[model samples]
Target: MKLKRARRSRRGRIEIIPMIDVMFFLLATYLLASLSMQRLDALPIALPDGKTAPLPSAAPLTLSIDRQDHIEVGGHAVALADVGNAVRQQLHDDRKVIVAADDKATQGTVTRAMLAAQNAGARALLIVIRHEG
Candidate 1:
């Protein structure tokens, strides 16, 4: 006598739960990797230290000077002669300005930029320096 065999049934539907988990893991991994690769926009420099003070409520204008003595007002490059005018245009009622100078930059260049900020009617001037480690 021949025995009869039963065939198992199979479902063709796709499983989505595992795929969603894998996608989430990949997204998290990429996010972490991207964060590690982020960089600061300001030029690296050694800064002087002083007593910490509260920042003003209004956003202050940023002026940067690189080692090469290149001057930038609010991230836009400007000639030394035009620094004052550029600063003036950005000044509002707050009239605050922040100057960041590279450690290798000459004192003369930094002084000139500070003077320009003053001439532009900056009521408050703040120098940005790296905190001593």
Candidate 2:
């Protein structure tokens, strides 16, 4: 018989532990980044629900109150006394006015505007809110 052929023990494939370690490291990194970006939002307001028909898209009169409590309509500053007369003349019949009040403004100011709009014979008075944005 010929000389016995030399045979070496076979080596199996190595387990991929480094791949699992990399996957876990990537997961941790994403989790930490996502947590850092988390932020709180403002309180929610509930809108009324009903099966109402849509209103026409008429251009609404916008009234805004600044931090100093000054009132402006259509980007023009006007005296509080003249608001009703002015709105009455400008608005057409069957249209409502929009009052946009800032957080710094008092409730009375907004209420006064609404009351004025109503007194001027506005069909409806709507209070515009920041939530609309």
Q: Say which candidate scores most in TM-score.
A: 1
**What CA RMSD would candidate 2 show?**
11.3
**CA lDDT of 111 in candidate 2?**
79
Runs in model 1 deviating more than 4 A are: 1-44, 49-51, 54-58
Q: Roughly what TM-score does model 1 have, to 2 decimal places? A: 0.66
Q: After superposition, how far is residue 86 of candidate 1 from its true place, in Å?
A: 0.7
Candidate 1: worst-modelled 10 consecutive residues by lDDT: 39-48
lDDT for each residue of candidate 2 in 1-133, tens digit (9 for 90 to 100): 6887599778998678988999999999999999998742212222323343444697576666655557766556666777787677777655677666666667787678777767877787665543332
RMSD of each: 5.7, 11.3
Clashing pairs in 2: none
After superposing candidate 2 on the true structure, give the runs of residues whose Cα lies further than 4 Å from its correct spot.
Answer: 1-56
Give the per-residue lDDT digits (tens) of candidate 1, residues 56-77. 6766888888888888888788
lDDT for 100 in candidate 2 is: 62
RMSD of candidate 1 to the truth, in angstroms, is 5.7
